[model samples]
Target: MISARERLLNYAILIVFSAAALFPMIGVVAQALQFPDLDAGTFRDAWREGHFGTYLRNSAIVTAVTVACASVLSIMAGYALGVLRLPGSEALFLLFLAGLTVPTEAVVIPLYFDLRTLGLDNTYAGVILPQVAQSVAFGTYWMRAYFRGVPRSLIDAARIDGASSWTTLWRVLVPMGRPAILTMVVLTSMWTWNEFLLPLVILNSDEGLRTAPLGLSFFQGSHQTDYALLTAGALIIAAPVVLLYVFLQRRFIAGMLSGAVKE
Candidate 1:
Protein backbone atom coordinates (compact mmCIF):
# COMPACT_ATOMS: atom_id res chain seq x y z
CA MET A 1 0.00 0.00 0.00
CA ILE A 2 2.90 2.34 0.60
CA SER A 3 5.00 1.57 -2.45
CA ALA A 4 5.50 4.56 -4.72
CA ARG A 5 6.60 2.29 -7.52
CA GLU A 6 3.36 0.28 -7.30
CA ARG A 7 1.24 3.46 -7.34
CA LEU A 8 3.14 4.73 -10.36
CA LEU A 9 2.57 1.48 -12.20
CA ASN A 10 -1.11 1.56 -11.36
CA TYR A 11 -1.48 5.08 -12.68
CA ALA A 12 0.36 4.12 -15.82
CA ILE A 13 -2.01 1.20 -16.33
CA LEU A 14 -4.98 3.43 -15.73
CA ILE A 15 -3.82 5.94 -18.32
CA VAL A 16 -3.37 3.24 -20.91
CA PHE A 17 -6.78 1.71 -20.31
CA SER A 18 -8.47 5.06 -20.16
CA ALA A 19 -7.08 6.09 -23.51
CA ALA A 20 -8.10 2.82 -25.10
CA ALA A 21 -11.65 3.09 -23.79
CA LEU A 22 -12.02 6.78 -24.57
CA PHE A 23 -10.75 6.82 -28.15
CA PRO A 24 -13.92 5.57 -29.81
CA MET A 25 -15.89 8.24 -27.97
CA ILE A 26 -13.30 10.87 -28.84
CA GLY A 27 -13.38 9.74 -32.47
CA VAL A 28 -17.13 10.14 -32.52
CA VAL A 29 -16.90 13.62 -31.02
CA ALA A 30 -14.31 14.53 -33.63
CA GLN A 31 -16.66 13.34 -36.37
CA ALA A 32 -19.85 14.88 -34.91
CA LEU A 33 -18.41 18.33 -34.69
CA GLN A 34 -16.74 17.73 -38.07
CA PHE A 35 -14.15 20.39 -37.63
CA PRO A 36 -11.48 18.99 -39.95
CA ASP A 37 -9.94 22.02 -38.41
CA LEU A 38 -11.19 20.64 -35.03
CA ASP A 39 -12.44 24.08 -34.06
CA ALA A 40 -15.61 25.61 -32.50
CA GLY A 41 -18.08 24.47 -35.15
CA THR A 42 -18.82 21.13 -33.38
CA PHE A 43 -22.07 22.20 -31.76
CA ARG A 44 -23.38 24.04 -34.81
CA ASP A 45 -22.91 21.05 -37.09
CA ALA A 46 -24.38 18.61 -34.53
CA TRP A 47 -27.54 20.66 -33.98
CA ARG A 48 -28.00 21.28 -37.69
CA GLU A 49 -27.62 17.67 -38.81
CA GLY A 50 -28.38 15.38 -35.87
CA HIS A 51 -31.75 14.50 -34.37
CA PHE A 52 -30.06 14.35 -30.99
CA GLY A 53 -32.93 16.04 -29.21
CA THR A 54 -35.46 13.38 -30.13
CA TYR A 55 -33.05 10.55 -29.55
CA LEU A 56 -32.09 11.96 -26.18
CA ARG A 57 -35.71 12.16 -25.02
CA ASN A 58 -36.46 8.65 -26.23
CA SER A 59 -33.41 7.18 -24.52
CA ALA A 60 -34.32 8.92 -21.27
CA ILE A 61 -37.87 7.57 -21.27
CA VAL A 62 -37.08 3.94 -22.05
CA THR A 63 -34.01 3.79 -19.82
CA ALA A 64 -35.81 5.30 -16.83
CA VAL A 65 -38.87 3.08 -16.99
CA THR A 66 -37.03 -0.16 -17.60
CA VAL A 67 -34.45 0.51 -14.90
CA ALA A 68 -37.16 1.31 -12.39
CA CYS A 69 -38.81 -2.00 -13.11
CA ALA A 70 -35.57 -3.96 -13.06
CA SER A 71 -34.33 -2.49 -9.77
CA VAL A 72 -37.63 -3.23 -7.99
CA LEU A 73 -37.77 -6.77 -9.32
CA SER A 74 -34.12 -7.47 -8.52
CA ILE A 75 -34.30 -6.15 -4.98
CA MET A 76 -37.38 -8.20 -4.09
CA ALA A 77 -36.15 -11.38 -5.76
CA GLY A 78 -32.71 -10.97 -4.25
CA TYR A 79 -34.11 -10.53 -0.73
CA ALA A 80 -36.25 -13.59 -1.14
CA LEU A 81 -33.17 -15.58 -2.07
CA GLY A 82 -30.78 -14.13 0.51
CA VAL A 83 -33.00 -14.37 3.62
CA LEU A 84 -36.12 -16.34 2.90
CA ARG A 85 -35.67 -20.00 3.89
CA LEU A 86 -38.31 -21.47 1.67
CA PRO A 87 -38.09 -25.16 0.63
CA GLY A 88 -36.08 -26.11 -2.48
CA SER A 89 -34.79 -22.52 -2.49
CA GLU A 90 -31.39 -23.51 -3.85
CA ALA A 91 -32.89 -25.23 -6.87
CA LEU A 92 -35.17 -22.30 -7.60
CA PHE A 93 -32.24 -19.89 -7.29
CA LEU A 94 -30.45 -22.03 -9.87
CA LEU A 95 -33.38 -21.50 -12.18
CA PHE A 96 -32.94 -17.73 -11.94
CA LEU A 97 -29.21 -18.12 -12.60
CA ALA A 98 -30.03 -20.39 -15.55
CA GLY A 99 -31.94 -17.52 -17.07
CA LEU A 100 -28.59 -15.75 -17.20
CA THR A 101 -27.25 -18.45 -19.52
CA VAL A 102 -30.08 -18.36 -22.07
CA PRO A 103 -29.15 -16.19 -25.02
CA THR A 104 -31.60 -13.42 -25.92
CA GLU A 105 -31.23 -14.24 -29.63
CA ALA A 106 -32.48 -17.78 -29.10
CA VAL A 107 -35.60 -16.37 -27.51
CA VAL A 108 -36.10 -13.44 -29.91
CA ILE A 109 -37.72 -15.47 -32.70
CA PRO A 110 -40.37 -16.78 -30.35
CA LEU A 111 -40.64 -13.38 -28.65
CA TYR A 112 -41.25 -11.67 -32.00
CA PHE A 113 -43.95 -14.07 -33.05
CA ASP A 114 -45.64 -13.83 -29.66
CA LEU A 115 -45.45 -10.04 -29.59
CA ARG A 116 -46.84 -9.85 -33.10
CA THR A 117 -49.72 -12.01 -32.05
CA LEU A 118 -50.43 -9.61 -29.18
CA GLY A 119 -49.86 -6.47 -31.31
CA LEU A 120 -47.04 -5.43 -28.97
CA ASP A 121 -44.35 -5.32 -31.65
CA ASN A 122 -43.03 -1.80 -32.19
CA THR A 123 -44.45 -0.70 -28.82
CA TYR A 124 -42.36 0.92 -26.06
CA ALA A 125 -43.52 -1.73 -23.60
CA GLY A 126 -42.42 -4.45 -26.00
CA VAL A 127 -38.89 -3.09 -26.19
CA ILE A 128 -38.66 -2.62 -22.41
CA LEU A 129 -40.36 -5.86 -21.31
CA PRO A 130 -37.73 -8.13 -22.84
CA GLN A 131 -34.83 -6.04 -21.58
CA VAL A 132 -36.32 -6.08 -18.08
CA ALA A 133 -36.47 -9.88 -18.21
CA GLN A 134 -32.85 -10.10 -19.32
CA SER A 135 -31.63 -7.55 -16.80
CA VAL A 136 -33.47 -9.26 -13.94
CA ALA A 137 -31.30 -12.39 -14.10
CA PHE A 138 -28.02 -10.53 -13.58
CA GLY A 139 -29.60 -7.95 -11.33
CA THR A 140 -31.02 -10.60 -9.06
CA TYR A 141 -27.64 -12.28 -8.82
CA TRP A 142 -25.82 -9.09 -7.90
CA MET A 143 -28.47 -7.95 -5.44
CA ARG A 144 -28.56 -11.38 -3.84
CA ALA A 145 -24.84 -11.14 -3.23
CA TYR A 146 -25.33 -7.73 -1.64
CA PHE A 147 -28.25 -8.84 0.49
CA ARG A 148 -26.35 -11.89 1.72
CA GLY A 149 -23.75 -9.61 3.26
CA VAL A 150 -26.26 -7.77 5.43
CA PRO A 151 -26.34 -8.90 9.08
CA ARG A 152 -29.05 -11.44 9.83
CA SER A 153 -29.28 -9.99 13.32
CA LEU A 154 -30.75 -6.90 11.74
CA ILE A 155 -33.58 -8.96 10.33
CA ASP A 156 -34.03 -10.82 13.60
CA ALA A 157 -34.21 -7.57 15.54
CA ALA A 158 -36.75 -6.18 13.10
CA ARG A 159 -38.84 -9.30 13.43
CA ILE A 160 -38.63 -9.13 17.24
CA ASP A 161 -39.84 -5.55 17.08
CA GLY A 162 -43.03 -6.85 15.45
CA ALA A 163 -41.97 -5.77 12.00
CA SER A 164 -43.70 -7.61 9.21
CA SER A 165 -41.75 -9.00 6.28
CA TRP A 166 -42.78 -6.09 4.08
CA THR A 167 -41.94 -3.54 6.77
CA THR A 168 -38.52 -5.03 7.41
CA LEU A 169 -37.71 -5.07 3.72
CA TRP A 170 -38.74 -1.49 3.06
CA ARG A 171 -37.93 0.30 6.31
CA VAL A 172 -34.72 -1.48 7.20
CA LEU A 173 -33.26 -3.55 4.40
CA VAL A 174 -33.94 -1.17 1.56
CA PRO A 175 -32.30 1.76 3.31
CA MET A 176 -29.25 -0.34 4.08
CA GLY A 177 -29.18 -1.37 0.46
CA ARG A 178 -28.82 2.14 -0.95
CA PRO A 179 -25.46 1.39 -2.51
CA ALA A 180 -26.64 -1.87 -4.03
CA ILE A 181 -29.83 -0.22 -5.22
CA LEU A 182 -27.91 2.56 -6.88
CA THR A 183 -25.63 0.02 -8.50
CA MET A 184 -28.64 -1.81 -9.86
CA VAL A 185 -30.08 1.44 -11.19
CA VAL A 186 -26.84 2.37 -12.94
CA LEU A 187 -26.28 -1.06 -14.48
CA THR A 188 -29.83 -1.48 -15.74
CA SER A 189 -29.91 2.05 -17.11
CA MET A 190 -26.72 1.60 -19.11
CA TRP A 191 -27.75 -1.81 -20.44
CA THR A 192 -31.19 -0.61 -21.48
CA TRP A 193 -29.90 2.64 -22.93
CA ASN A 194 -27.16 1.04 -25.00
CA GLU A 195 -29.33 -1.85 -26.08
CA PHE A 196 -29.43 -1.96 -29.87
CA LEU A 197 -30.04 -5.56 -30.84
CA LEU A 198 -33.27 -5.96 -28.87
CA PRO A 199 -34.80 -2.69 -30.00
CA LEU A 200 -33.84 -3.33 -33.60
CA VAL A 201 -35.41 -6.77 -33.46
CA ILE A 202 -38.55 -5.67 -31.63
CA LEU A 203 -39.25 -2.28 -33.08
CA ASN A 204 -40.07 -1.71 -36.74
CA SER A 205 -41.46 1.81 -36.66
CA ASP A 206 -39.76 5.20 -36.61
CA GLU A 207 -42.97 6.85 -35.48
CA GLY A 208 -43.00 6.67 -31.67
CA LEU A 209 -40.35 4.09 -30.90
CA ARG A 210 -36.66 4.45 -31.68
CA THR A 211 -34.12 4.17 -28.87
CA ALA A 212 -30.96 6.29 -29.06
CA PRO A 213 -28.86 3.27 -29.99
CA LEU A 214 -31.29 2.30 -32.73
CA GLY A 215 -31.66 5.94 -33.75
CA LEU A 216 -27.88 6.21 -34.01
CA SER A 217 -27.99 3.37 -36.50
CA PHE A 218 -30.50 5.30 -38.54
CA PHE A 219 -28.28 8.38 -38.32
CA GLN A 220 -25.22 6.44 -39.43
CA GLY A 221 -27.08 4.97 -42.39
CA SER A 222 -28.46 8.32 -43.54
CA HIS A 223 -25.19 10.17 -43.04
CA GLN A 224 -22.40 7.73 -43.64
CA THR A 225 -20.31 10.45 -45.19
CA ASP A 226 -21.27 12.97 -42.52
CA TYR A 227 -18.95 11.87 -39.79
CA ALA A 228 -19.78 14.98 -37.76
CA LEU A 229 -23.43 14.11 -37.33
CA LEU A 230 -22.58 10.48 -36.64
CA THR A 231 -20.07 11.48 -33.99
CA ALA A 232 -22.60 13.80 -32.34
CA GLY A 233 -25.16 11.00 -32.26
CA ALA A 234 -22.60 8.72 -30.67
CA LEU A 235 -21.76 11.32 -28.05
CA ILE A 236 -25.44 11.83 -27.30
CA ILE A 237 -25.77 8.15 -26.51
CA ALA A 238 -22.58 7.89 -24.43
CA ALA A 239 -22.56 11.09 -22.36
CA PRO A 240 -25.08 10.06 -19.68
CA VAL A 241 -23.23 6.85 -18.80
CA VAL A 242 -19.93 8.65 -18.53
CA LEU A 243 -21.37 11.34 -16.30
CA LEU A 244 -23.23 8.82 -14.16
CA TYR A 245 -20.11 6.80 -13.48
CA VAL A 246 -18.02 9.86 -12.78
CA PHE A 247 -20.45 11.29 -10.26
CA LEU A 248 -21.51 8.04 -8.66
CA GLN A 249 -18.11 6.37 -8.52
CA ARG A 250 -18.18 6.17 -4.72
CA ARG A 251 -21.58 4.49 -4.56
CA PHE A 252 -20.66 2.16 -7.38
CA ILE A 253 -17.51 1.02 -5.62
CA ALA A 254 -19.29 0.68 -2.28
CA GLY A 255 -22.13 -1.34 -3.77
CA MET A 256 -19.71 -3.64 -5.58
CA LEU A 257 -17.74 -4.18 -2.39
CA SER A 258 -20.86 -4.95 -0.39
CA GLY A 259 -21.93 -7.50 -2.95
CA ALA A 260 -18.57 -9.25 -3.35
CA VAL A 261 -17.15 -9.21 0.17
CA LYS A 262 -20.02 -10.88 1.97
CA GLU A 263 -19.27 -12.51 5.32
Candidate 2:
Protein backbone atom coordinates (compact mmCIF):
# COMPACT_ATOMS: atom_id res chain seq x y z
CA MET A 1 0.00 0.00 0.00
CA ILE A 2 1.15 3.51 -0.73
CA SER A 3 1.81 5.61 2.34
CA ALA A 4 -0.01 8.86 2.97
CA ARG A 5 3.25 10.79 2.68
CA GLU A 6 3.99 9.19 -0.69
CA ARG A 7 0.53 10.08 -1.98
CA LEU A 8 0.95 13.62 -0.80
CA LEU A 9 4.34 13.91 -2.50
CA ASN A 10 2.93 12.57 -5.76
CA TYR A 11 0.07 15.04 -5.63
CA ALA A 12 2.47 17.88 -4.95
CA ILE A 13 4.62 16.92 -7.91
CA LEU A 14 1.63 16.67 -10.20
CA ILE A 15 0.31 20.01 -9.04
CA VAL A 16 3.64 21.69 -9.74
CA PHE A 17 3.90 20.23 -13.23
CA SER A 18 0.29 21.00 -14.03
CA ALA A 19 0.71 24.62 -13.05
CA ALA A 20 3.96 24.87 -14.99
CA ALA A 21 2.26 23.52 -18.08
CA LEU A 22 -0.78 25.75 -17.74
CA PHE A 23 0.93 29.02 -16.90
CA PRO A 24 1.95 29.80 -20.47
CA MET A 25 -1.51 28.97 -21.76
CA ILE A 26 -3.01 31.30 -19.16
CA GLY A 27 -0.62 34.04 -20.24
CA VAL A 28 -1.59 33.53 -23.88
CA VAL A 29 -5.28 33.78 -23.07
CA ALA A 30 -4.69 36.96 -21.10
CA GLN A 31 -2.66 38.47 -23.90
CA ALA A 32 -5.32 37.50 -26.39
CA LEU A 33 -7.96 39.33 -24.40
CA GLN A 34 -5.91 42.44 -23.57
CA PHE A 35 -5.83 45.97 -25.08
CA PRO A 36 -9.44 46.00 -26.22
CA ASP A 37 -8.93 48.61 -28.90
CA LEU A 38 -5.81 47.04 -30.39
CA ASP A 39 -6.96 43.47 -29.74
CA ALA A 40 -10.51 44.04 -30.89
CA GLY A 41 -11.56 41.48 -33.49
CA THR A 42 -7.99 40.25 -33.60
CA PHE A 43 -8.92 36.57 -33.68
CA ARG A 44 -11.50 37.05 -36.43
CA ASP A 45 -9.14 39.21 -38.47
CA ALA A 46 -6.32 36.73 -38.06
CA TRP A 47 -8.56 33.85 -39.03
CA ARG A 48 -9.63 35.56 -42.24
CA GLU A 49 -6.21 36.93 -43.10
CA GLY A 50 -4.42 33.63 -42.45
CA HIS A 51 -6.90 31.62 -44.50
CA PHE A 52 -7.24 29.26 -41.55
CA GLY A 53 -10.26 27.57 -43.08
CA THR A 54 -8.07 26.04 -45.74
CA TYR A 55 -5.38 25.13 -43.24
CA LEU A 56 -7.92 23.57 -40.87
CA ARG A 57 -9.41 21.50 -43.66
CA ASN A 58 -5.98 20.25 -44.62
CA SER A 59 -5.13 19.44 -41.01
CA ALA A 60 -8.39 17.61 -40.50
CA ILE A 61 -7.84 15.52 -43.61
CA VAL A 62 -4.27 14.62 -42.69
CA THR A 63 -4.92 13.94 -39.02
CA ALA A 64 -8.05 11.91 -39.60
CA VAL A 65 -6.50 9.71 -42.28
CA THR A 66 -3.28 9.25 -40.35
CA VAL A 67 -4.99 8.35 -37.08
CA ALA A 68 -7.49 6.01 -38.73
CA CYS A 69 -4.88 4.14 -40.73
CA ALA A 70 -2.40 4.03 -37.86
CA SER A 71 -4.97 2.79 -35.37
CA VAL A 72 -6.14 -0.06 -37.54
CA LEU A 73 -2.65 -1.14 -38.54
CA SER A 74 -1.40 -0.89 -34.97
CA ILE A 75 -4.28 -2.94 -33.61
CA MET A 76 -3.74 -5.68 -36.17
CA ALA A 77 0.02 -5.76 -35.67
CA GLY A 78 -0.35 -5.71 -31.90
CA TYR A 79 -2.70 -8.69 -31.98
CA ALA A 80 -0.30 -10.69 -34.11
CA LEU A 81 2.76 -9.98 -31.99
CA GLY A 82 1.14 -9.95 -28.56
CA VAL A 83 -1.32 -12.83 -28.84
CA LEU A 84 -0.47 -15.03 -31.78
CA ARG A 85 3.29 -14.82 -31.15
CA LEU A 86 3.97 -15.10 -34.87
CA PRO A 87 7.29 -16.58 -35.95
CA GLY A 88 10.03 -13.97 -35.90
CA SER A 89 7.65 -11.70 -33.96
CA GLU A 90 10.31 -10.47 -31.58
CA ALA A 91 12.48 -9.35 -34.50
CA LEU A 92 9.47 -7.67 -36.13
CA PHE A 93 8.54 -5.94 -32.86
CA LEU A 94 12.11 -4.68 -32.51
CA LEU A 95 11.97 -3.35 -36.04
CA PHE A 96 8.89 -1.33 -35.17
CA LEU A 97 10.52 -0.23 -31.91
CA ALA A 98 13.45 1.10 -33.94
CA GLY A 99 11.14 3.74 -35.34
CA LEU A 100 10.78 5.32 -31.91
CA THR A 101 14.53 5.87 -31.63
CA VAL A 102 14.90 7.45 -35.06
CA PRO A 103 14.46 11.21 -34.88
CA THR A 104 12.17 12.81 -37.49
CA GLU A 105 14.77 15.42 -38.46
CA ALA A 106 17.25 12.70 -39.43
CA VAL A 107 14.85 11.19 -41.91
CA VAL A 108 13.01 14.30 -43.15
CA ILE A 109 15.56 15.10 -45.87
CA PRO A 110 15.43 11.61 -47.36
CA LEU A 111 11.67 11.49 -46.85
CA TYR A 112 11.28 14.79 -48.75
CA PHE A 113 13.21 13.46 -51.71
CA ASP A 114 11.34 10.18 -51.65
CA LEU A 115 8.01 11.96 -51.60
CA ARG A 116 9.15 14.19 -54.46
CA THR A 117 10.11 11.16 -56.51
CA LEU A 118 6.67 9.73 -55.85
CA GLY A 119 5.13 13.06 -56.82
CA LEU A 120 3.60 13.41 -53.34
CA ASP A 121 5.59 16.41 -52.14
CA ASN A 122 3.58 19.62 -51.59
CA THR A 123 0.60 17.31 -51.10
CA TYR A 124 -1.37 16.15 -48.07
CA ALA A 125 -0.32 12.54 -48.77
CA GLY A 126 3.31 13.41 -48.14
CA VAL A 127 2.53 14.73 -44.67
CA ILE A 128 -0.07 12.12 -43.79
CA LEU A 129 1.99 9.03 -44.71
CA PRO A 130 5.04 9.87 -42.56
CA GLN A 131 3.00 10.88 -39.54
CA VAL A 132 0.91 7.73 -39.87
CA ALA A 133 4.06 5.63 -39.84
CA GLN A 134 5.32 7.39 -36.71
CA SER A 135 1.98 7.08 -34.90
CA VAL A 136 1.71 3.38 -35.79
CA ALA A 137 5.15 2.64 -34.35
CA PHE A 138 4.17 3.99 -30.93
CA GLY A 139 0.62 2.69 -31.11
CA THR A 140 1.74 -0.87 -31.90
CA TYR A 141 4.06 -0.89 -28.90
CA TRP A 142 1.37 0.48 -26.62
CA MET A 143 -1.38 -1.88 -27.77
CA ARG A 144 0.90 -4.91 -27.76
CA ALA A 145 1.76 -4.31 -24.13
CA TYR A 146 -1.90 -3.97 -23.24
CA PHE A 147 -2.90 -7.10 -25.21
CA ARG A 148 -0.12 -9.20 -23.75
CA GLY A 149 -1.53 -8.56 -20.30
CA VAL A 150 -4.78 -10.42 -21.13
CA PRO A 151 -5.52 -13.66 -19.27
CA ARG A 152 -4.42 -16.85 -21.01
CA SER A 153 -7.62 -18.55 -19.92
CA LEU A 154 -9.71 -15.93 -21.63
CA ILE A 155 -7.92 -16.44 -24.92
CA ASP A 156 -8.09 -20.22 -24.57
CA ALA A 157 -11.78 -20.05 -23.83
CA ALA A 158 -12.33 -17.98 -26.94
CA ARG A 159 -10.59 -20.62 -29.00
CA ILE A 160 -12.57 -23.42 -27.37
CA ASP A 161 -15.77 -21.66 -28.32
CA GLY A 162 -14.86 -22.13 -32.02
CA ALA A 163 -13.98 -18.47 -32.55
CA SER A 164 -11.51 -17.56 -35.26
CA SER A 165 -8.53 -15.44 -34.31
CA TRP A 166 -10.04 -12.43 -36.00
CA THR A 167 -13.34 -12.91 -34.21
CA THR A 168 -11.63 -13.47 -30.88
CA LEU A 169 -9.68 -10.27 -31.27
CA TRP A 170 -12.52 -8.06 -32.40
CA ARG A 171 -15.18 -9.51 -30.13
CA VAL A 172 -13.41 -10.74 -27.03
CA LEU A 173 -10.26 -8.67 -26.68
CA VAL A 174 -11.16 -5.43 -28.36
CA PRO A 175 -14.26 -4.96 -26.22
CA MET A 176 -12.25 -5.49 -23.06
CA GLY A 177 -9.50 -3.24 -24.42
CA ARG A 178 -11.62 -0.16 -25.08
CA PRO A 179 -9.76 1.97 -22.58
CA ALA A 180 -6.38 1.18 -24.07
CA ILE A 181 -7.64 1.67 -27.62
CA LEU A 182 -9.36 4.95 -26.80
CA THR A 183 -6.22 6.24 -25.13
CA MET A 184 -4.21 5.42 -28.24
CA VAL A 185 -6.72 7.19 -30.46
CA VAL A 186 -6.74 10.29 -28.27
CA LEU A 187 -2.93 10.42 -28.20
CA THR A 188 -2.55 9.83 -31.94
CA SER A 189 -5.17 12.47 -32.66
CA MET A 190 -3.30 15.03 -30.56
CA TRP A 191 0.03 14.23 -32.23
CA THR A 192 -1.39 14.32 -35.73
CA TRP A 193 -3.31 17.53 -35.12
CA ASN A 194 -0.30 19.38 -33.73
CA GLU A 195 2.21 18.04 -36.29
CA PHE A 196 4.26 20.87 -37.80
CA LEU A 197 7.63 19.71 -39.03
CA LEU A 198 6.37 17.15 -41.57
CA PRO A 199 3.81 19.59 -42.92
CA LEU A 200 6.45 22.29 -43.09
CA VAL A 201 8.94 20.13 -45.02
CA ILE A 202 6.44 18.49 -47.33
CA LEU A 203 3.91 21.21 -48.05
CA ASN A 204 6.09 24.32 -48.04
CA SER A 205 5.11 25.33 -51.52
CA ASP A 206 1.38 25.11 -51.00
CA GLU A 207 -0.32 27.56 -48.65
CA GLY A 208 -3.60 25.74 -49.09
CA LEU A 209 -2.01 22.49 -47.93
CA ARG A 210 -0.64 23.94 -44.67
CA THR A 211 -1.74 22.44 -41.37
CA ALA A 212 -2.82 24.42 -38.30
CA PRO A 213 0.61 24.77 -36.71
CA LEU A 214 2.15 25.69 -40.06
CA GLY A 215 -0.56 28.26 -40.66
CA LEU A 216 -0.03 29.68 -37.17
CA SER A 217 3.65 30.18 -37.97
CA PHE A 218 2.88 32.19 -41.08
CA PHE A 219 0.21 34.08 -39.14
CA GLN A 220 2.83 34.97 -36.54
CA GLY A 221 5.28 36.18 -39.18
CA SER A 222 2.65 38.44 -40.70
CA HIS A 223 1.49 39.73 -37.30
CA GLN A 224 4.98 39.96 -35.81
CA THR A 225 4.18 42.95 -33.61
CA ASP A 226 0.57 41.96 -32.87
CA TYR A 227 0.73 39.94 -29.68
CA ALA A 228 -3.06 39.69 -29.35
CA LEU A 229 -3.57 38.25 -32.81
CA LEU A 230 -0.66 35.86 -32.41
CA THR A 231 -1.98 34.57 -29.12
CA ALA A 232 -5.50 34.29 -30.48
CA GLY A 233 -4.28 32.35 -33.50
CA ALA A 234 -2.34 29.98 -31.26
CA LEU A 235 -5.45 29.33 -29.19
CA ILE A 236 -7.56 28.77 -32.25
CA ILE A 237 -5.09 26.22 -33.57
CA ALA A 238 -4.95 24.42 -30.18
CA ALA A 239 -8.62 24.43 -29.23
CA PRO A 240 -9.55 21.15 -30.97
CA VAL A 241 -6.83 19.18 -29.19
CA VAL A 242 -7.84 20.74 -25.87
CA LEU A 243 -11.47 19.83 -26.40
CA LEU A 244 -10.57 16.23 -27.33
CA TYR A 245 -8.66 15.74 -24.08
CA VAL A 246 -11.47 17.36 -22.09
CA PHE A 247 -14.02 14.92 -23.47
CA LEU A 248 -11.80 11.83 -23.11
CA GLN A 249 -9.95 12.58 -19.89
CA ARG A 250 -11.61 9.80 -17.92
CA ARG A 251 -10.86 7.01 -20.38
CA PHE A 252 -7.36 8.35 -21.01
CA ILE A 253 -6.51 8.33 -17.29
CA ALA A 254 -8.07 4.93 -16.72
CA GLY A 255 -6.15 3.40 -19.63
CA MET A 256 -2.87 4.87 -18.39
CA LEU A 257 -3.41 3.56 -14.87
CA SER A 258 -4.89 0.15 -15.74
CA GLY A 259 -1.50 -1.43 -16.28
CA ALA A 260 -0.28 -0.38 -12.85
CA VAL A 261 -2.25 -3.14 -11.13
CA LYS A 262 -2.37 -6.82 -12.12
CA GLU A 263 -4.71 -9.58 -11.07
- For each candidate in the order shown, give its overall lDDT on alpha carbons: 0.81, 0.88
Candidate topping lDDT: 2
Q: Which pairs of residues have clashing backbones in candidate 2?
A: none
Across 197-234, the per-residue lDDT of candidate 2 in tens digits comes to 88889997988889999999998898898776777788
In the predicted model 1, the residue pairs found to clash are 31-228, 32-228, 35-38
Candidate number of the best TM-score: 2
TM-score of each: 0.87, 0.95
Candidate 2: RMSD to truth:
1.7
Q: What is the C-alpha local distance difference test score of candidate 2?
A: 0.88
Model 2 misplaced stretches (Cα beyond 4 Å): 38-40, 259-263
